[model samples]
Target: MIVTVQPTGISAADVLAVARGDARVELSPATVEAMAASRAIVDDIESSGRPVYGVSTGFGALANTSIAPQRRAELQHALIRSHAAGIGAPMPREVVRAMMLLRVRSLAMGRSGVRPVLAQGLVDLLNHEITPWVPEHGSLGASGDLAPLAHCAIVLLGEGWVLGKDGARMSAAEALHGAGLRPLDLAAKEGLALINGTDGMLGMLLLAIEDAAHLFAMADVTAALAIEAMLGSERPFLPELHSIRPHPGQAASAANIHRLLQDSAIMDSHRDDLAHAVQDAYSMRCAPQVAGAARDTLEFVSLVSSRELVSVVDNPVVLTDGRVESTGNFHGAPLGFAADYLAIAAAEVGAIAERRVDRLLDVTRSRNLPPFLSPDAGVNSGLMIAQYTAAGIVAENRRLASPASVDSLPTSGMQEDHVSMGWAATKKLRTVLDNLTSLLAVELLAGVRGLQLRSPLAPSPAGRAAVAAVEPFAGTPGPDLFLAPVLEQARAVVAGRALRGEIEAAVGPLS
Candidate 1:
């Protein structure tokens, strides 16, 4: 599919598609016209004989300094070279692609006073799969992902490192040549426009939101499996009960759980049986409430991502009129808050899932299941340590969930004080999301084991399919083996592969 970046708007799904390398990006003619018009304003400003913030003057603390016309090109080049100061590991290729796509989307709006060719350079990189080696750190995510994006912008200037179109180490010049493109000689205001935007953080947030949607749904699917394995009731998920709360996420989660738990012999047998307690543990009883909150967080972050997709974020953006103005539209507090909030909610989902795994393993609490789901109870140690792994990840998430946006530090000689450390928040969020998947997978593996032990009493339709989806790799449980391979496979299934789809097929699309 082709994703057309217009002057007016773009979609979250389109961004995801570009990130995943599933779609091509086309810059609309209107976007090209807009860029030309905006560039005209910058050209006029440069000729006006007055120093503008980014066009003629130096950046940040150096704003008062002006460059001679002969050295203005050098100034743009120097800005990119100096600001490409990021350290540590390179960003993943998909993240780079997403960020590049968003940067192009912003430029297409023509509010950044950059030329059409500059935006096409970004689109061309995506088209040919030439990913710049962007560092994961260095951006405060205000003044809009400056350092990270400079690393990307320098690639377009053919002065930075990139994995070439063929995915081998190469210089940016070599890569762009192969893509039938040239290194740009950046014009006035062009360099600042290239490097100034929320693309880096916002791109990751968009992809994370997409991943979280699937993981959030799987949270419910796996939670149902755990509940059924432990013979917990689904009465808490009744529409009558959820209708009172009316939170969209809570209601949706309840409906999914209710669908997954429908027509269960285990639940039916325990519904009236006095052996079971009046209710299950909060982990089991309130799965919807917890996972639902995460779902809601995902929704809010999506809203932010969508709004950001359409916004022109930069310092000294070009106005629709002939005026050029400096503004704080580049601030990342909105994205920072969303990313941090999501980490907290996603961590809780993992936390609750870990608790359920603990319950399924402890004989006293598991009701009838063997300790650790061990076949021999004393020697096998089946999945006992896996629970520990899950616990550790959940515990780590508690710290990662602490808001990074609240902590501020001055930069650029205190001219840019009270900065938002959103990049740190988002970088940590990536880890939390990965850990959440693994935590849920351990619960899934344990729950399936418990269900197998139940014998003659099979799971509900959705639960049966959910188990079937992973059982091929997780295997029928037994004594100790190299369980890591199996656990990783189960993690893949729960993180979003075949299991959820199998369950949806059986129960009809899980709400």
Candidate 2:
């Protein structure tokens, strides 16, 4: 696949294709022309000798200092070298690729006053699979993800470490040489333009949103399975019930649950008994409500991500009228808030799932299922420890759920006093989602076993497919066997999308 980045914008799908799928990247002709036009403005400003923020002047706390015209090239080089100070372990390959693509997309909007070749240098990095070895720390997210992006920008100058096409660490010079590409000689405002944006956080946010979207869909499927396994009433998911509240996400979830439970024999077996407790517990009955809220939060986060995608988040933007102006577009508050919101929402999803898993393990709550759904009760120990694992992850997720955006410290000699910490937000969001995936996998294991113990009483067609999908990983339920591998295999079923795929194939697409 070839993703032609336009001046207008790129889509989240395109970003994923290039970042995760190694799709080739190309700058649209219009983007090239737009970049050339913007560069012309910077050149005129450079020769005129009037002081500009990133053109003739120094950066950050040194903005007021003027530079000799002959030393401007050195200034750009110094900016990249000095700012490439990120520390910690290297980031994942896909994240670095996404950040590079987003920065190029921002420059392609023609407001960063950078040359076409500079933007193409980034594009070349993507196309050739030359991923810069960016460290995991050193971004305040105020003046963009400075340290992280500068780590990337240094590669453009052939002065940083990189993972070559074979994914082995090497010098940027060596990687560029192998790719038959030359290092760019950045001029004037190019270095500042390269590093000054919310690309890193925004890229992480985009990838998280995509992953969350899939997991949210899987949340509905697993919730339906849990509901069936517990012999819970499916009435709460009635469209008419959710219609009154009318939240789009809620309605979609309710509809998914409703369709997933259609004609379910496990539910049908108890329909005649009004004595089956007046209603199910909140975790069982209100699955849609909780997961629905997460869906809605993801939608809002995606809206913020989409807007940032099309926006030019440079420090001093070049105007169509030929004037260069400094603005606060680089601040990451919006991305920070979005990433934190997603973490909280995802944590809630896991919280409710843990509750449901706990219910399945306890004989007091799980109706007639043996303790821990163990076939041999005390001797087998069954899935008792699985609930413990789920609870532990849920507790950790709650800590990760604390909004990173709320905590900020001054940086750059108080020049950037109120930093966004959005990078921290996105980083924690990844952990939250990972925990959520594990928590849901626990629910899948317990839920499927609970359904199995309700012997001879079959589940819905969709539920039957779900059981088949997991039985291989979970094994025949009996005396306790080696369980670590079983639980890990079940987690693969949940995280790898096999369970959702089987359920959907049996019952068509879910909401």
Candidate 3:
């Protein structure tokens, strides 16, 4: 499908489409107009001989130095080459695509004063699936993710390495030329306009935010399954109970849990079962509070992303009245804090999921379930070590949950003082997501095994659907087997595969 850029907004789904290589991109007329207005400002600045920050002078610690008009093009070229110093593993192609899209979108807003040709080059890269090989590290998350974005700018100049459609790394010149394109000669403020922004951090966070949203929904689904597996009370999720204190996320979580348990004979039958009693443990009862907090964090992140996405985050924004303004909009404190909050929320989910896993394994705590959820506790270890793995992941999450935003170190001889470390925060959140996914997967697998021991007692319809979704991926307990694939499949479901779709079709869409 043709994915035209609209000034109104871009969605996560559009990004996913581009990542999957099923979409083409086009610049909207509004974007073209914005670029034209921005370029006009640049022309006026150049023609009037006013010294703009990046356009006429050097960057960062070298900002005081001025460039001669004759060497301006060389300065722009060197700016990209000098900053293309990112290191570590290459980022995923999707992240590169996201970075390009974000940069293009920001430039399209017209405040950056980049020429229309430069913005269109980014769109062309996306449309042709030419992804720059950006490294995962080297950004302090302030001063606009300079290193990674420099790599992107280098690709535009056709000087860096980029991945072709066949996944082979080739020179950007070769990649572009092979597809009937040529390198761009950046005009005044074009290099700064392209490289000077939080798009690097913003791109990764955008993808992570979408993943976190899906995981939040999955958290509720997995919690519902565990609640039914333990035959826990449904009273805590009652609408009237949530309405008394009405936080939107909490109310929404309560509603989701209620919907998952609705029309379930297992839940209905256990409601009056005195053996299960009036209340469940805190892990079961406080699911809304923990999960809802994560949802709230995501809401805050969405707000921050919305602002940053459309903003002119580059230094030296060009006003329509032909005035140039140097500013620190490139500082990433907003995204830094948002990423830190995301880590905290994600850690909480893992922490609570670990508790649920513990509950499912401990025979006394698990009510009627066998020790370690094994039919033959002595002969088979069953899910004994799964809980250990879950605990280890949970412990790791606690360390990762430490806020990167709270810590900063001065860089660039202290001229670029107070780094945001927001990129670090976002990167750590990705790790936390991976750890949480595995931990939750382990729990789901263990809970299913425990439920299997319950046999004809059967879980709630939602729980049964969840179990059936995972059952095909699980194997009966055997000695010293590789359980990674089983854990992976469970992670896929917990990450929101359409396992619930079958049940949804028979019943209705899961709330």
Tens digits of lDDT, candidate 2, 216-237: 9888888888888888888898
lDDT of candidate 1 at residue 356, scale 0 to 100: 96
- Predicted structure 1: lDDT: 0.87
Measured by lDDT, the strongest candidate is 2
Q: Candidates sorted by TM-score, descending order? A: 2, 1, 3
Q: Report how far off residue 456 is in candidate 3 (Å).
A: 0.9
Ranking of predictions according to lDDT: 2, 1, 3
Candidate 3 lDDT, 1-511, residue by residue in tens: 7767765446656766776554888889898888798788788777777778888888788988988888888898998998899987888887788888878777877788877888889888888778898888878987878898899889888899887667667799998888788899987778878788888778778888878877777778778777777878788999899889878888888787777777766677677777776778989999998898788888999899877766778788887787789888989899989988988999999899889888988888887877887777787776788888889999999999999998988988788889899888888888898888887788778767766666677676776776788778785444434677778888887777686565566446543
Model 3 ranges with Cα > 4 A deviation:
6-13, 20-22, 164-168, 475-481, 506-511
RMSD of each: 1.4, 1.3, 2.0
